[model samples]
Target chain A: MQRIVVLAGGIGGARFLRGLKSAVPDADITVIGNTGDDIHLFGLKVCPDLDTVMYTLGGGIHEEQGWGRSDESFAVKEELAAYGVGPEWFGLGDRDFATHIVRTQMIAAGFPLSAVTEALCRRWQPGVRLLPMSDDRVETHVLIDDPDGEGRKAVHFQEYWVRLRAAAAAHAIVPVGAEQAKPAPGVLEALAEADVILFPPSNPVVSVGTILAVPGIREAVADAGVPVVGLSPIVGDAPVRGMADKVLAAVGVESTAAAVARHYGSGLLDGWLVDTVDAGRVGEVEAAGIRCRAVPLMMTDTEATARMAAEALRLAEEVRG
Target chain B: MQRIVVLAGGIGGARFLRGLKSAVPDADITVIGNTGDDIHLFGLKVCPDLDTVMYTLGGGIHEEQGWGRSDESFAVKEELAAYGVGPEWFGLGDRDFATHIVRTQMIAAGFPLSAVTEALCRRWQPGVRLLPMSDDRVETHVLIDDPDGEGRKAVHFQEYWVRLRAAAAAHAIVPVGAEQAKPAPGVLEALAEADVILFPPSNPVVSVGTILAVPGIREAVADAGVPVVGLSPIVGDAPVRGMADKVLAAVGVESTAAAVARHYGSGLLDGWLVDTVDAGRVGEVEAAGIRCRAVPLMMTDTEATARMAAEALRLAEEVRG
Candidate 1:
């Protein structure tokens, strides 16, 4: 069985994992999900990225929305607002709230995030060993010109993304606790034993970038000596979904697909897949000392996404040679 | 305005408060809700009795159920169960969950239960000033004959009442932290400044009984020298609502209006109101050195409940004279 490890973030990563699972049904997949976006809201621990992956693979995700539970109700959110408690911007539904509550309860009981994720997955049965990047808290903070026109201030990633809609120009994207955080129990081991590692078409700066920021994760992928492949979230000169361009700019990367590949760089990433539209820039990515391929990267549906996953794997095989 | 202080529990107490609010719109009503029955579930602090009062008075309560929110969804509870985390019997709906989350968040932020209750009530505007009996944690535990047939085991009061449905014979109902708990900030002051204090037709054992169990609360009401009138929860030979009889038996009190009045005694209780069906027991209760009145005590509707509240006030005046 092929051992495939994927480092992922929320929505885009979740959808990619669902497709990858379809492309390689029998592969032993282990996912190291970004916990840099993990937040405590209403005293409940909400791991948006981990939940997105679980729900997407477990058949509970809201397909249209790309995150949260399908057929969800906002009763809990409304009630919290009614109590005059808010950061009312983040849309956590009732079904989604339960996940956070259970997680929070387990964490309070002294269980680590990775353990809690595993326990939650027992119900979702997301078909892979899902691990948080680290059991330690690591929140992504985006430094932006304060909306009120003061000096720059660092806002939580969710605040910048969900609340502000990434309207403000981001100056920097910092994974707040990543420097001191160790990889969760199975993270480094998964990297060591993996046949190939894939970085899903997630936000390069905040999602995949934050996961790489964890103390030893990027080093593990680099030293593992296995083909490390990545799918571009940016297509042509823009993100297919989400505000990836805004955060990419924070890290001084252009919105172009070739820029993201170069941002991960030749040292860490062995192979990079861009879109058919960005085929012209494939040479530029290849010149950066990373093998490159341009393919249809739009994840319009499962079949389309699965084909993209297969293309990524094919590129990984080419890099191996 | 007549400054009225009420000692209360859950549904029964909440309904009575609604009636009291209607009966004396100008009265400065202060409710010292029982907190011994508070249970922490899923890492959220759930104050069932306090929520009952808030929702009922705030017009958010399920009219038929009398406890949870109206139009509530069980999505959160169902999701929790799907994750295999539950007592399964306590039916907390999504809207109700928000209340717990907000309270838990505030508590975690170092707010006392009383202050949290006050903040929550600001949203509910429950017409009355609602205060928790004590700011400190106080969980009620019921010792019951072990279902495994070995020996008596103690269960959280909610497990005994909600999960077990009170089937097991209760040996004792212990307020675990009541001995060490002081009245919440406004509790003693509410009792001291009151012109009259009322015990609504709530469970004598777990409701009114638990409030009086808090050390200084009973003394404050007694020393206030104000008329302390109580409406019996027992209608004929049984409790008007809840399994008050089972818990009363645990405490060695007979399940009768006269018996409950005598249980409070003439010192703590200056007057007691039994239902019209138990009119004959009034003389027996008065002979026990307490002023007693026979009135319609069934809270079938707000109007009927308001009449009962008015009758309790009339009895309080009679005792004062």
Candidate 2:
């Protein structure tokens, strides 16, 4: 059985994993979900990326939104607002609140994020081994011009992305606790033993990039001696979804498939998939000593996404050869 | 204005207080709610009696259930059950979860339960000064026959009352932390300045009984030189609502109005009101040196319950004479 490791973010990553699962039902997949997007809301730990993967693969995700519980209701959020407790910008539904409550309870009982994730997965049975990027806290913060003051201020990535709608001017992205954080248990081991490693078309700056920012994780992926492949979240000259373009610029990267590939660079990403619309940039990417291919990168459905996953695996085989 | 202090439990206590508020709309009311029924569920502090009072007085109480919020949905509870996390028998609605989340967050941030209750009450605006019986944890545990083994074991009051529906034979009722606990900031003061202290139709053993167990509280009420009257939870030979009889029997108290008054004794209770059905016991109760009255104790409606509260006040006046 193929051992595939994927570094995932929220919606895009979760949807891709769904496709990957359908593409290779027998493959042993491990998801190193980015915890940079995790936020403490209403005193409960809210791990957006991890939950997106869990809910999406566990058959509990809202199909249209591609995140949160399917039959979600915002009664808890509404009540919290009534109590004047907010970050009301981030909408957490009642079912989603249950996940956080259970997770927070377990963490309070001294379990690490990885163990809590494992316990949660017992109920989810998402079929893939899901692990947070690190058991230690590694919140992603974005610097923005103070909305209320003169100088720039650092805000939680969720505040920047969810609350501000990424409407602020681009500055810099910082993983607040990444320097002291260690990759969660099984993270390094999974990467070291992987037959193929894939980076889903997740936010390069905050999602996949944040996972690699963990000290040991990037080194492990580089030294794993396996074919490393990635799908560009960017198609044409902008992100396929989300405000990825606004954040990509924060890291001085353009919102283009070829530019994102080059940003990861040939040393880390051996093979990169760009949408067919960016086919013209294939040569420019290949010239940088990385194998680049142009394919239909839109994850319109599971079947379409599976075809993309199959293409990436085929590219991984070519890179290995 | 008359300063009225009430020692309260859940449902029954909350309902009676609602009527009391209606009866004396101008009275300065202070409710020292029993914290003995407070339990930590799913790592969140749950104050059943406090919430019951807040909801009931704040117009959020389910009119039919007489507890929990009106228009409550148990999405969070159902999800918790799905995660195999329980006390599933104790239902927490989504809107109700917000209160716990805010409260637990505040407690974690070093606020005492008293302060937390005050903060929660601000939202409810329950039109009374509500205080926890004590700032310290004082969980009520009931000794019961071990269902799986021979002798006996202790279960939380909620487990005994809710999960088991009080079917198990009880040996003793223990307020686990009462020995070292001190009454909350305003509790003694409320008792000290009280014009009248009325014990609503709350459980004798677990509700008002637990409040008096906190050392200084009983002494303060006795020394207040104010009328301390009570409405009997027991009407005839049984409780008006709940399994008060089961718990009443646990403490070796008879499930009779006069017996309940005798259980409280003359020194503490200045007056006791039994339902008209137990009118015959009035003479027996008054013979014990506590003024006794027979009235309709059924909380049939706000009007009916207000009448009961008014009757308790009239008896308080008679005791003063």
Candidate 3:
């Protein structure tokens, strides 16, 4: 009867789900996907975080890239390149495009993203309930001085990340419309009923942080009356993957394990897990009234990821006791 | 100053354009695309024929299939299958989905399909003006008995053809709203100013026929004052490719070279090409007041297709002389 809820970001979140599934195959796992990374390209809504989880769990994911499906092709993308559409930096393959189209179509047809995600998950049969952080639109836009245009303008996250390759420093990172977004159906219920909550080694700022930004979500998790444990996305002083260091700077957060644990703080986190490399910072994190543990968090393989998931679960139990 | 206006369908149309480019290297080619096959699936508007031309001329087309770009994948489609959302007959690739997304988005943003096609073409750089017959909606719906429900109902052309695999006999074919569809921008002008007009081996009923259905387009071609030459899609008593027989029956035209020639009529066609197999029918086509020519119309390769283009040009010149 253990109900576990996890908040997640893209690649990291998807990878963590893989581990969590392995660790608790029969547990009622509910994942709250970050929608801040969602982007519209070529008229299709692409929720990278959601798809990653779907592919990873469905066993269609590219084992190495940990993102798109295996054996991907670029014909459609090349054709699109010929069409000169979108922020081409993010490699949207032909096969991946279909998912976006279906999701986009469903969203346009008035289905909330959570329901759309569920419908998508049915085919993937990901063996867990997946919920979007919010049903309302909340895009991550970066305010930067336009190098080509007059003054500063908000550019799509993909444009800032993929197209520009995240070369330009982001002045301000805003999850557009987050203040107005409502928790998706089943999201709050999943958190309130959960015996434990785990933040997989997903981006603490953009992934789980974005979930907290949803009006009622953070409050619901804090009041869930259970252990809320987060594994640090940072190891020593760097992120596990992607340009998290660059994004962390945009929000005035240091790319350190201690800083991430402190960012979640006693407000929501009951326990925090840091990598062995950051064992020295355990006292600092624990001083914030959060129980802390040191463990290996790199998801090098399924076994390693599952080990990390097991450690998080063990910590959650200790915090509750 | 050879302004060649081509009325085209899908793969056949795109293959012919490759040859037409070689025959008249400097000819200003304007392709008026058929929108009858345009479909809305999962809310995204997909224009298959338009993509064929763009891909073929841009050198991104699948060399074997003659449609979609070469080296394509179905990851997105597979993912969509996992989600269980679609009519599921037409195979959509991930990379290809991006093009439709951009086009659909732009169209939603008030850009006409014609303009959207142009925007898409800029990326493909297909070296020709590609125009949809109309920007206003015109979907070719086939009347068939409801597969799940009782009685007769109109199903989308894609559903009838791809999903059902054209299993049921079509009771009626209607290009919905074509009567109200205005010729897309530049379609009529290209026809009126053409030095020569070519009808590639596209489906006469669903492909070229739909383009002509746009108001003022068919009349403009008939009165263009240029020699209008059409290569027969019907090589013998069958379509060179595709289910032209099924489509021909829907439009009440027999699947024969002579019948197709007469379907276009002498008022429109100056020269009609018949394959060597239909050489015996050439005299009958000529009696319809069209100067008919017998030639090897099989587009087996670029060289063979180019020769076919040269013969059509020579026939057009002979008729004028």
Top-scoring candidate (DockQ): 1
lDDT per residue (tens digit) for residues B1-321 in model 3? 788899988899999999989888888999998888988766878899999999899987889877775666676676567567655668776566767767877889998898889888877889999998898999999998788888888988888877887777787888999999999988888888888899988888889888888889889999988899999999889999988888788778999999999999998899999999999999999999999999999999988999999999999899888
Clashing pairs in 1: none
**lDDT tens digits, residues A83-168, model 3?**
56645688877567667777777788888888889887877888889898988889889887786777887888878877876677
DockQ of each: 0.92, 0.89, 0.53
Q: Give each model's whole-structure lDDT.
A: 0.92, 0.94, 0.86
Arranged by lDDT, best first: 2, 1, 3
Tell me how far the alpha carbon of residue B86 in candidate 1 is from the true structure, in angstroms, after superposition: 0.4
Better of 1 and 3 by DockQ: 1
Q: Name the weakest run of 10 consecutive residues (lDDT summed) in model 2 chain B.
A: B59-68
Task: Estimate the lDDT of model 3.
Answer: 0.86
User: At residue A24, what lDDT does model 1 achieve?
Assistant: 96
In model 2, how many backbone clashes occur?
0
Q: What does candidate 2 score in Cα RMSD to the true structure? A: 1.2
Q: Which candidate gets the maximum lDDT versus the true structure?
A: 2
Q: Per-model i-RMS in Å? A: 0.6, 0.6, 2.6
Tell me which of candidates 1 and 2 scores higher on TM-score: 2
Deviation in angstroms for B196 in model 2? 1.2
